[model samples]
Target: MRPNHSPEYVQSDNSLDVAPPYFFPNVDVQGFVIEADLKAVQKYCDDFLNLGTREERGFEYRAVPAWPFAQLLFLHYPVMISAAPDVVKGGNGRDSENPIPSSNPDFIVPMADRGTTSQNEVFAAIPVMRYGVGPKGLLVESELEWILPFIVVDQPWSCVCGREMLGLGKMMSRIDIGPGYLPGSFLGEVHMPGWDGNSPEMQHDLPFLYVQTGPALPTFRATEPLKSLATAFQAKPVRWALEKIAGLSNFVDDASLGLVPTTMQTVALKQYRDAVDPECAVYQALVGCRSKYSEISNLDFYDERDIWVMFNYVGSFREAVDVILGDELKKPLVVYPELDKTVSITGRMAKVVGAFKFSANVDFDDMRVLHEFDIRKDRKEGGHGQVLKRGSSDLTARWFRPLKGFFGPRPMP
Candidate 1:
């Protein structure tokens, strides 16, 4: 790879010859050269090719060849600096309560009229540089400079630079959180040109690592049911509520489904705990379900069906109760109720109601999961094959394994 170099600035009439803010390359080229073996290189290429093409929400795209390697590098290395809490602190000066405030008016730069200075303000910043193959098997680098600060005030979840960084001008597209390489984690995906520029016919749906604690606020809001679930079960209550409501008949066993047996209380409690408790088998199954969805989205496109299904299941439960009892079952019902009015004071029903309410307010498009990506263990274990000896001269000529087969099925000449 070419050694990291600072940008040269041209003298201007009003401003001194100042270099534009450039994102520094974060990958250790010499380390990659020494550590990467043929098997590892081949696996990286295969993973990229396996992504193939994807179509979602009427948009078609593919994964760039360098995407896998880049993802691995960013996740495993300390390339990204987590945004300080103060950097994204809300206007009220609270750390996690409010949305990040816009930059000061004096610091705002005027560009093409976006109609608001908030859109022009900078909030949280992440500098990224991509590595790929060049002509003559040389490693080339490209900087995502314009896409630095991910603004929060005007457009909460969108990158301020948007498609301008891709040289595609302004587009309706916005960057969003998607399934990550690991379960219970998320990554950022956007539609852009491939690294090689080979696929002019189709855009690449590239995925990259982002700082989890960045300026962007979560799109999904936790509802009462979700809160109750977390409080009662310390797990995803919305998912649990949906499952319980979907299989209401199995638990209640009533033709009208209005009456529930008080004796089944132990069974119901076990079922809920089994599904939500991290130590239980059903909890692993839930995690597996999330992992499977992530795998599917990586191969195809991000699908909202799974999320919608959870919400739909909850709605169906609500409808069933309303039809059978002629009254709304405001909470999720997992077991039969006791006739004793004193039992109602135990707050079990409140938890159920919260879960049901959470389902109704669930925003399928706003879901995200956390993935912990750290390779310190691998380094400690000395799993990085053979690394080259470090020296000043050796660092200058850093090399990276050529990523072949990036462009899928090149047309025959």
Candidate 2:
């Protein structure tokens, strides 16, 4: 909105000088200022007034970027104007079938499309059994392990998109360790906060730590191709976008532990896989890493299977295990993309939708005393003496101690 009052013009040595509070006050409109594009500013003002209306709402408004810029501009010179509520609501409308609405005065405002770019790629977490050099040049088969899904993207946010486009879920909850003396006992008692009987103050018995492995690959749904090619392209951008929104570091500590895959390696692997299998089918294109499972009751003493054994021994451990191993232990953890499920992408941006599934078994032998209570006086006074006399469960002078304090002394029976 332009100001109603006009500023006085004065004659300067070279040209006419406008006084304070000139039209478009505080805005540098000098012709010599080459950076200022008057046409663009005028269009923005016109659009602000006319575009966000009931009849013809603006498309591709890019609100993600535009809103902050508009706020900065408004901060300098506050303006208040009232118009139709739908006018300010732009981009793809609520319903996919009718993204943009016609002129309905009572039309409901739909969720705006996130005006950011995104990419897509296939991802999988397979159990790999491989041989590696041990301490004395002897090759040993690496313990049975599942590789966390590795994602890469030109934009870090797209990493999330690529994972999602491949149909992986979000991360599992933070792992909780319970007080225990042995690694096997520690594994068996490990639980997550908010789980049925676990609490934050419950300290782990052994020295141990665990981290989430980013988002997890989905298990229930059958494997299928990603919804669209555009979605596939958004994979990298989506990951970075998520990194920006929610710190990716919070999900996993990649720097300390070399668990997360490198960006270059992930990209290279996807390219190789896609090139070998152009169809881009998740299951057909990806190689399955064979997983071996031993029943909890039959595991060895020092094997990782100790976790399974401990888990079976304590029924409380079932909740966390069920999240990773699925409701039924008989079912193997399977990851595959689903073409039927799709996330809305805007300008390479998409919201993280589901939770991830992560499984980690921590084992350390070190022990620490958490808390202690003084019971020497109680022991000497027989405070904890068992009631062996055959009488009704009633108070008796022989089983009780009388108080001797400054207030008063009591006689013993």
Candidate 3:
């Protein structure tokens, strides 16, 4: 992956050089540990707690990856500094083989303005780099040179082939949060203090590490029923009023659709929680009916044009149920879907829904499950597996694992 910022406007499509979100490379129980391994997770989190900001710019810790790694710049020498937050992998930068020198070195995918397909923006293949040693290799070393007290960092990066990525620098830190974006200020050309208007060659240096903080939007990823379930808990009086109208036949039957309490740390809405436990209510209604989605979106995409965005805001439960249950549960609903990252909320079960067992449903046609993780204690242990009976919104029942995952997937090396 490359740093999300650019040296100049013509050089990259990055208008938002804001700090990269620390949440890149998201991790979950059955997912890969982004960048460093488990050891790094605790270390990085601890670093922010102990030495991070509120004092000077240093290790800033946040619930998501958007603020710290993506924003703060790290200094190395007197001439250059590192790019905060790196961009998703792909895209041959201007200096790189954009309209690649070619498979034939002359075969360019012309742009429409330049007389070619509009969607066919010529791009060369970007080489993928792996850490090599860790479970999934992470960046271990790189330099950030200080160009001045306030200007942006300027330098190049060297790839495994010894070819220099002219404008690229080493990514000091890389990570992904559950589902959050970093501020735009950290990634753009840094504000170089004391930078002469037309100076030729000048430089300065200062202490490196920096940190910042912001609110943590902690939410979970569930199907339409799950979110609709969360909605059911919006207002106590409304919920209570609806329940009376719901009656026995009206409720959706599932194993447990209630609030996955473990998922609520920084619940975005207190009013919803205080009013109802839609998570539990919804889960129970959907029990035996369907629990999760069918096929899951593959989290890893090797290019900028493709991605596995997280679906955090599963539609509202109360509204859905209101429609399913009747006029008694009338309430306005909102759609809350996350546009990035993967997430898992433990203790996932529906109260009034159906009483079903969780199971891993892999297919002989797809071996990705085995390739992604090792099999361990089945769904019984509650490791990483599918809870049977996916909802209508969840793709199809086919989107589950055939076998349970005892541990998370290790990131790419």
Best candidate, TM-score: 1
Reference-based lDDT, residue 199, model 3: 45
Candidates' C-alpha lDDT = 0.21, 0.22, 0.20
Q: Judging by lDDT against the true structure, name the best candidate.
A: 2
Candidate 2 error regions (>4 Å) = 1-112, 115-146, 149-165, 169-260, 263-413
For residues 21-112, write the lDDT of model 2, one tens digit per residue.
11111111000000112233333323321222222211111111211111000001111111112222223333667655666333433212
TM-score per candidate, in order? 0.16, 0.16, 0.15
What's model 1's lDDT at 287?
5
For every candidate, C-alpha RMSD to the true structure in Å: 25.8, 35.0, 28.2
Per-residue accuracy of model 1 over 1-413 as CA lDDT, tens digit each: 21355243222223211111111112111000001122333332233221221110111112223322111111111121211122111223323543332444222111211122112111211112222234322232221211111122123212322221211112222344434444433343222222223334444432211212111111133223433111233234423453455334343223212111101100000011233333322210000000000100010111111111011112122221122122433445332222243432211121111111010100001111111111222233435434332111110111221333343343344
Write the residue-wise lDDT of candidate 3 on 1-413 in tens digits: 32254253232322212221111111111110011122332243333122212222111222232211111112122111122323222443223444333434223232211211100000001011111122221222111111100112232121110111111112212222222133211111111112212345443321111121121111121122423323334334644543453323223122113211011011000011112433221111100111122122111111111112111112221221111122231223222222122332211111121011111111111101100112222323534455342222111112122221323453355
Give the least accurate 10-residue stretch of model 1, judged by summed lDDT: 284-293
Positional deviation of residue 80's Cα in model 2 after best superposition, in angstroms:
33
Would you list the clashing residue pairs of candidate 1?
185-370, 185-371, 225-354, 225-355, 260-336, 331-353
RMSD of 2: 35.0
TM-score of 1: 0.16
Separately for all candidates shown, the number of backbone clashes (residues 3 or more apart, or on different chains) is 6, 43, 94
Ranking by TM-score: 1, 2, 3
